[model samples]
Target: MAHEKVNRTKFLFKIIFIIIIIITILSFSTEILFIPTSNNITTPITVLPPSFNSSEEKFLTYLPHSGFHNQHDAFINAIMLSYLTNRTLIMPPILTNYYPPWSTFHSLYNALNKSVIAKKYRKEHCYIKNDGNGENIDNFCDNNKYSKYDNFTMLNWDQLFDLSELKKHVKMVDRGYDFSLDNLISDFNVGENDTYLFIEDKRFEFEFFDNDNSTRQIHEDFEKKFLISDLIKIDKKLLHFASLFHINRIVLENQHNIEFRHLIHNTLIINNSKLLNIANGIIKKLGDKGNYIGLHIRIGDGIYIDEAEDNKILIFNELMNYLLESGLLRNSKKFFKYNLKECVSHNLPIIYLATDANDPRKNLYKFYKNIPCVFTLMDFSKDLENFGNIPSDFDEDTNLKSFYVPIVDLLVTAYGNFFIGTPKSTFSMAAVEINNLYHGKNALVALP
Candidate 1:
């Protein structure tokens, strides 16, 4: 009888233990469910600005007005967030439905291809209107196909930003010098908001003017009449609040310069644990046992200002040498720089992603000969299959949104936006900013 009683007691304890374990699992599942559910719940936006009592609070204004490329949106958002406490982002009015032109798409494909040479690749092959510009000029001429539509025109920088709807929200002040950096800062400060947003067409006010949609022609004519340094000077001056680069503006040309260095020093860093985890996950997936480094090289004509005469091969050599000497590449404590030699020696792999494929001039293998890397070109293009089903067309006046999941993930994971591209690209700048934010520091080193 005593033995039976002891067995019953043991059975009762087992049941209790099982119940407790089940309860713990249920609790954990509920917590996990709540997190994602809360993320999906959208907060209602209140348009009113926060009430302020201080009169000394100066507003910092950010002007990101032009709507040329979809990549510019990231830069626009970065500036808005950077100066969030004392700033407001005044978006330019949306213009016509715009998509990237054939030339631009062609350039993107070429850049991606060269970046990951000898890798598998594919892109969305769609029949966009070939209105006889650049490569399509011959196609249109051969068939006498210029007269598809008389009103089908490209959107100008100024035309892209109508601002009629936003006029009521903004008080217009004539900056005496017309888009001068100093004038932009003073006019937008309404005494309440510390950072105000005032934007205009830099090309029209300071760079070039175009009444017709002949920007390429206007750029050529303007270059003869002006200097790129003049625009660079204005950019240097305006680095205080934010400079929204459109039309291929993101790059590291001026990264080593004083002004950009100063900008980097002033910003704060916010690290995202999630981003770090994602990066670590990628490294493990690639079977990276030891050293890893990022080699960011951009190809295609669009990446350059005007395909400057410098041989890209020489540029690649210079960049590689810089990387070899940099501490990030030399030191194995925190970072392990991987190059062609190191990849061969250590059997390290590379994760290369590009925007284009059909370019001959880019020397892909010469720089990354022995490096093993992952290429998402094929898989990435596959996801874009259903993009055409969307009701909206790519609009030049407004920004066109693209989903580059693999590239974005790689960029974010590596914390590598600083060394990504040219100065005239918002895409590169935003990438750097995002990487910086992910790494939890404003001043990030893109070693080469």
Candidate 2:
């Protein structure tokens, strides 16, 4: 009976073990069927950041037509306007007649450098591309090849800024869109024309007898209007007043002139390495020898005007008298006693003359020939040859070198020990500003 019980217990144990194994297999099979696989898994969807607000509340301004210096003035005013109105400035491409239309910023400056500069400034300001849509536009150098547009060529902004970030805020406009300041301000919908516009608004002509009071009132009025308006287009009038206000504020606050100087320098980039090298060489040569007088003679195109010849002669005489009084030049007697000896020993009596005059031996050139040491752009003929032949008169087909020559001359003039420029000449004005900043003095000025 005991043996029978032991066999029965072993059979019961074996039955229990088999039941456990079956349950384990069922559990494993259930898990294998129910667990998620790669094919069945769901992924979280990603979304891009929202685009800039497409409301009419944003203000836009078009830079007016003019030469490089005037265009630059407009640029500065645009910046001030944008800051005041909290608007995104749509900058016009730098325009020149050399290409019979335009030369883009990229054509004149380092693309990579421009990008870096734009990025640096955009953090504090809203600078957008030509497209109204805030899309990042890169490769400004390649994108703006067809610069010719409506009797004007479009130059790339990369000559001034990287513009990639600014491009993001660009509101693209359709061709031949009405860009009038009144229309832009009054229209409910600007459409693609919102991207960029060029207008010839009249200059704001308001004389302020009391600058402080007038500027304060202007600021107050602008702020009040700007806060309520959905769209504020800066007409020439507003721009002029705003520019005056800001400029006065800067002066009143005793701000460093370097701020303006640096801005101009940073924006007006010279990309041509050969041109830049030549300019640097000239500046260095002048510095190495001794103090030099820099003079800008605006006589080339002036000859065509009625009284321009008389004006030129007057300006020339005034400049000479001023130089003598300022001790930059010695009188005939002083020249023999001091200047002549110094010129012979150290090249102290030298004149670095920059002029639009074509003929080397005629016109204003004759006035400068008597100087002990005189140099003009022609002295750098070998270096300029690298740019190919330059035309005597710029036309639709003028070479890039011809367009760039003035910039090179401007750079050399800016580095002179003392600089004098002609009245109302933007080229001279730019040189004076640059010279003042570089030399830490107010030594640059147009003839009074």
Candidate 3:
């Protein structure tokens, strides 16, 4: 009888364990469970968290396009639109690209670092095959390693942002990846007739001012500014924006709205602790908070690339003038008196260079050679050994550590006491925002 009781207990325990697994699977009806394959590899699946509310409220959404910062801009605009209209927000997966520096950059890097023996010093080129049909093949690197990464990855919203913290100010939700009115309407979120799409010149961007009393003509390029208050009068169930990419897409002129925007920006901090911890470790390696000087230089593409030499000089000089004015240097004449070697000998402030120039040693080294103790993300690879923990967008098989370098640059360089970045580049703009946030300052932090 005693032996039979023990057997029964074991059998019950097994049944309970199986039931718990089933319940857990059912609850995560909207998340991805990584199932490992025979090779100990998992497929790269974009997890779009579903938060379909039963509440009969209107919704607002926009197509997320371009790189991370561009998508970030559109998201901010979408949430503001949702708030102003008092509607729920339907978010699409944030689109990311694995386009590394052009092939020439890699070619130059390999040539420049040929003497360097450390594996950590080597940069990863985009190994994912892409459709470069009918375009200048010279524009991209062809070192395909991961057949799955096609230059783009649809990342979940929470992967880049704290959706819960952001949703506190706005009612945001995601309905898989589709933004089609038909699909959303099918979900019973709204009717076709009840929806309103801001149909404008699809090729050009138009600004939508939030306040009725403000006359802020931000951009004149595709010239069209509409008031957000007018949309509220439509009384529709869903307000769809075809495109909202520009930083000033939704200009907040009202003082109250401006204040609220600041609050929202503060709350919309980078959500990943793993990334922050990695950043903190990098910061510690860089001598910690307020100890170093940060500089972000964007050489840009196309016409900007032609003007790279001139633009980089302008940015570098601006940084110099800034340092001189701030008394960081001994004297205006002695600025850059120490070469990198001498700077290290003298123990001058470390200069962290956050750039998109591909091969900085070849293309940009001459420009900043006079700086004391100049370093890039590659210089601190030992500290960034856990960058693998940094979530990437594409195939899990492909170690797209290169994809997060710019992001890591932003995080690490933001801690510098003196920070300056390229004007008008969204990447630079992000660096400034981050610098300010880390120091408990406003979003538009003062820069040189």
Cα lDDT computed for each candidate against the true fold: 0.34, 0.47, 0.62
How many backbone overlaps does candidate 3 show?
Answer: 0
Q: What is the TM-score (0 to 1) of candidate 3?
A: 0.70
Question: In candidate 2, what are the lDDT values of residues 1-448, reduced to their tens digit?
Answer: 9999999999999999999999999988865552322221121111111113435234444433445565665555454334334444545455544222122222222332233333333322433334422342442222243222212223434543343332232222211223234444444344453433322122332222211332334332222212112223333212212122122122111122233333334444445566667777766666532267777777666423454476557666876786678766643544433332365465455667787778644776545544445677776766667667543221223344645678878888767776778766778877887677666644332211
Please give the distance, in angstroms, between residue 433's alpha carbon in candidate 2 and its true position after superposition: 0.6
Better of 1 and 2 by TM-score: 2
Q: Which of 1 and 2 is the better model by lDDT? A: 2
Number of colliding residue pairs in each model: 37, 27, 0
After superposition, which runs of candidate 2 have C-alpha atoms over 4 Å from their true positions?
1-59, 98-152, 160-274, 287-290, 302-304, 322-345, 388-398, 441-448
- The parts of candidate 1 lying over 4 Å away from their true place are 1-292, 302-311, 322-353, 357-363, 370-420, 443-448
Name the candidate, 1 or 3, with the larger TM-score value. 3
After superposition, the stretches of candidate 3 with alpha carbons farther than 4 Å from their true spots are 1-55, 98-151, 179-181, 202-205, 300-303, 326-347, 389-400, 445-448
Ranking by TM-score: 3, 2, 1
lDDT of 1 by residue, 114-134 (tens): 322211111122134433456
> What's the residue-level lDDT of 112 in candidate 2?
22
Report the number of the highest-TM-score candidate: 3
